[model samples]
Target: MLRACAAAFIVAAGAGAALAQSQPPITMAINQSPWLNSFVAMVDEYEKETGNKVELDVTPFGGLLEKIRNSVRGAQGAYDIVNVNSLWLSEIYSGGFLAPLGDVQAGYGLPEGVLTYGDTTNWDAEAGTFAGGGALMGVPVNGNVQVLYYNTDIYAKLGLQPPKTWDELLANAQAIQNEGEAYGFVPRAARDSIVYNFTPYLFSHDAAFFRIAGSGKADVVVNSPEALKALETYVKLATESGPPGPGNIAQGELIQLLATGKGAQAIAVIAAWGQLEDPNASRVVGKIDAALLPAGPAGTVASSAGHWVAGIPRNVPPEKQKAALAFLDWFAAKERQVDYVRAGGVPVRGDITGADLGDDAAFRFIGAYSQNAQHAVMGLPFAQAAEASDAMALSLNRAVIGEMTPAQALNQAAADLAGVLERNGFAVTKLPDL
Candidate 1:
């Protein structure tokens, strides 16, 4: 494994060089994320190497979409590059906001590891199917995936090994709870948290939200028996072993709980690992370790990927566009990628899974994280993905708070999801009865 950007270095070689020399500062619309500091460090390195100034229009995660949308919709888009998440990538692509990655670049072919990202990196614009069948879109700067994190000190003190199955995880949680030394677990349940936090549970149970049937059809499997079981395990893990008033816990709170040494175990994104090692914000520094998510009743270890992609807007000026694309090439180079990881960024290169973590033993998490990400499933890839997620998010929150039984909540969510697909012009037929 190597630490570096592996995107195909494309052609036109030196065609864009002269134009990029005098290009305006490349503007990028990106969100504030756990890996942002590392990203910025890479950006700084790019500037120092290429003399290309970059303006990062950083905003909250939720606000990023609107900002990118406002820019991409205009005649001449505001930003040169837009950072998109797998969850809503279809929205940007389907709207024709992004130009194909090869349109304005001069780089080598994509690295084998980069192609492992599949639809997150490529798509079929004509067929409207996301199978990496069409042109490449962008590089996956963040190879984010869900993994179980445990406090090594706590696990050793209690003589507990990292759980390999959901049942074992719950048992460990209960054991930690009985000890009263720290909270057994922490779950993010507030406002859109359940979808991301609980996806590994759903996937481990062999459940999926939707299965694309064809270019214009899909089957909704969100309320299946497997999903119900997954949901049950999710709620049980949170309420029985998690901290008090678990319903209000969100991403920040979950990280805070673990970083402050108040939590023993939980599942979180690989990108979030940076916070655990930050000396100023984390008391659990050097005590935390990560592993693949435990297997579910179906004996599957699965997780959700929320990798972030970088794309150039079609409407941006040629010089700015070239500069932005070149920045991507510079940022992804092997040397730069190693530096990126060393600065606290997750590597998107599958080849890097074997890289030595230097003196930091904590970087062992990268192996687990990268291995898990290679097989991780995405949240959704349809243009109406946000609406679909909202439909389920409501039900998930209700179900988590015990306002509705798992059956009732998922049933309602499935029904609403069907309507969303139908309205979005997808012929949705299959429905699961809970």
Candidate 2:
């Protein structure tokens, strides 16, 4: 009897070990953003339902990139999943640092729209494939776009409607400046924030960093006349209509200026405006409204589409990779996407627009911005894109300080940008036809 009892105990221990092995937890690393908190909550709900554990290693957004790069290079598999900006997907996917998600999506029985491969308009086709890399690397976490946020009170006080064209924007700026008590406009012109604000102008004029060659490579086209014109126009606005020393104005100060009613208008990301609507977070509660960026010479308003993407790392085992993909599939379901939107996260799914949320004015504006984002450009390959931003910031600074002509500043920037492209292994090509 004693021998039989001991044998039964050993068998039970073996069974417990096997069960544990079958349900190992999946680990993920995410940048600290509001969306991440929602993801955590979702993960908890999923774990309760499925008995699958999730471990998250959260880090500041600034440090997350380096950590991901180093881990991928070292094959350390520190994270099974990571969130990255859509712009970096090309580099990471082409370099084989990310696992192919197509098969994983299929194996998990993910629903349509939950696993988007190409552009939303042409998902089955390869329209959004990154430079013909031939694989869908990641799933978009959020859909973001740039918009013009104005002080409605200021506009009413000055008898001005939102500008429809660049010229009109300039004229309105002048009108605001003539008031003398309030600054005309405030945009990010400093190194850290200028890129986000300046890219929209580049788009509004239909200029891009590179022109796509038929052979899936990109040729540099940053020095085009349209680009120069856009840069020159930006210089004029920063110097003539914006706050004094516009280039020296940091992002925090810019936001504060707008929130405290010191500034008339700002070109900002839609998400930033949502943050300002939060009662605990904003000083400006009912004073703001969003509109499309002014039209440029191209006769249309173009904006930059910024998206955050999530994907499984290649270093993980196939089984674990499959599990991570499963979690992502669930996280991107339309219901969950609505939850993300309610939490101030942008929605990538077409079915959930800001207008569907309710009668809130902010949500309605955000919906309009989302529609514009669908037509915006993507896939620019700026080597050290961050540094290129700094160069633009410097040119604006010079113009604001009255130290250089707009033409001179832009010309110098063109030359510097050519060097940046060449260093990144791109051939210096002719500027785009403006």
Candidate 3:
């Protein structure tokens, strides 16, 4: 009996030694965002619990793609783990930079349906798959979708109800302008951040930058009638109801405009909910609430998902890869995610399934936000997402600034997309007559 106990102790010690010896310090590449301070806040605790060192490099959103591009192209081992935006998954996975999550399934526990934004049948598609391909690439770490935020007092004073359609939204904007209160609406329109905000508008009009996946052949569809109409609506609204020079405004600036009451309403990202409701950070606190984005001519209110995900780089050593996956699993767990949200991080999980949000102003829209996430489209899932986005931005900016009409701008964008697709060896099945 004494010998048996001694044998068990030896086996346990051996396992511990194996773990300590194999895993190296993890280096994670993340986007620079204030909300992610929650991750930084918990690093010490994570290291203490795991007995592993972690190094975090937060790159600016504009520069992150280039930084990640260099890492993948060089296989430089610069990052063992990377926090990637949804649009970058296609390029990153195709570059062979990410290790399949399924390969490391034993390293983490997969959450059930109740904890994921989508159900079991679709969670894998939404959270795991890269570019609609059947490979699990990463675990979601953030929730970002567009929602409508309006100043309740302003709406009441203007006798405006929350907009339920784009026409109504336009009318509301017109009302604010005619009444001489403030900018009617605000949203990011700068080149660097335009695509993220523009996608919801594109979807609302049933226009897509590319038919990136599915049967037959993929194609660029940016010059369709729907796309032209959407572009016209966006440019007109910005010129008439939004602040002058919207082409220079981005997410942060738009948020400031709304929070300070310079804007009466906004179609903005969900990450700013905490700031919008905080009395210390906003002048409109207790006077603002969020609603689903207004529907388009098609009677659909589609949005694009902009969440960040944690993935392991394929260039890392096996042990370090294991450690990276372990970190992702721990960091994205239900308890940690909830704590992160409470600490100003964006909520990504559906774990609040049965928990009561109960009129807490900070949490009132979470359930609605989650529902929006399910219907959200992920943009232009192609190996050249960045390149395609740059092309679209140039044309979109021209239209917004009145340097070109919407039709001219969209025609140029469609041509650019066609060139990109053909250069990447994909056949363009269809294109607008332009």
Candidate 4:
């Protein structure tokens, strides 16, 4: 039986070797995330099957863009595959750094429902295609959405219900803090992550940084009434109930605070929810549950998608490109995605929802994530997306650190984005009256 199993595995791997031969080793650049552990585990198997070397260059999230810029500008071909956040798609695609996957996708013909993991609430086919649906540019590998994580024990002890609205959320936080339970909540406030942390509130209140005009201009609207309401609400929550020195907090620190039971609740990315139930990493094992973000007064519940998409770089040699594309298809297949989920990686394949897991902590956490996907709002798409986002992040940080009032911060941010739009050749008319 053992020999038969080994023979079958080798047979299954034959296709990998058939894809290419005598090609230079392939390289992939991706951000440092917990799921990298699973990817590392699969490398040996991939090597055996493909008879080719594969190297991964994992870097901190902040350093990813600089690496891409340097490599692509130099035409160094240092990486064959590049992992990109959904937010980075527009900027990277506009630079022509990625090779369109039209031929490769047609040959592979990846089945439908396989790629439908994250929010498609605002997904546009043209954004993922070239020349208005000519070619595929990227493939989704992981999904992220915002969820409210709460300490079940604390809520039960205080006879409190999970908050369902903004007012209820704030009131619960104040009540929890008043009773000396834990820090009422924790939120990522560092400039690098603050925009994602705050956007859910902005979307919930129907506010936006800018809207794309029909003529392809960005109409700055960050200083509108709806934006002010969202900003003030986010600031008030962080100021009144969040931990001291929140301006320094990032995603890792927020997870640490929650896992150690120092925080009673948080609105955070669903990808990190597994940490609270990890026996080796958490003091709050079996005591945490997740739910959708609280709604705004207008009954809007919104979230932001943080999905990562992979694409081949234009610099790779033709033979090496074929190998890289084959590996990409194999790695993102449904079987591997299921294995990834079992290893605590975030699932992006639609078929591997929480229902596949037994009734346990993992199931409970992912259930919230699956439901929240329906409300995700992919941000505005444009070449200056990252620049505008950076400006907004700084404004959020300023408000959090008490350097500026929410209105002052937002007004300045709006002016800064307007300048960015104008410099990018997007004629900015009068600010929209939102």
TM-score of each candidate?
Answer: 0.86, 0.81, 0.81, 0.81
TM-score winner: 1
- Model 2 Cα shift for residue 386 (angstroms): 3.0
What is candidate 2's local distance difference test score? 0.65
Of 1 and 3, the candidate ahead on lDDT is: 1
Q: What are the root-mean-square deviations of the candidates from the true structure over C-alphas?
A: 5.2, 8.8, 7.7, 5.3
TM-score of 4: 0.81
Candidate 3 C-alpha lDDT tens digits along 1-434: 00001010001122223344335788888887876566665554455555667788878899888888777567457888787777776667666677777776553345542223222112223322233335666777777777888888889998899888888999999999888888988857898888777887888888888774443257678888898888888887788899989999988899999889999888787877878887898988888888788778978777767777777777778878888776666665565555555556676676553253335567666765766776677666666777888877888888888898989988888888788877877767556555
Q: What are the Cα lDDT values of the candidates? A: 0.78, 0.65, 0.71, 0.73
lDDT of each residue in 145-185, candidate 1, tens digit only: 88889999999999999898989999999999999988998
Runs in model 1 with CA error above 4 Å? 1-25, 32-34, 51-55, 59-63, 105-109, 115-118, 126-129, 297-299, 317-322, 353-355
Alpha carbon deviation, residue 322, candidate 1 (Å): 4.1
Ten contiguous residues minimizing lDDT sum, candidate 2: 1-10
Candidate 1 lDDT score at position 175: 95
Name the regions of candidate 4 deviating beyond 4 angstroms. 1-25, 43-54, 57-64, 70-76, 107-110, 114-135, 297-299, 378-380, 401-404, 430-434
Off by over 4 Å in 2: 1-24, 106-134, 212-218, 360-362, 391-393, 431-434
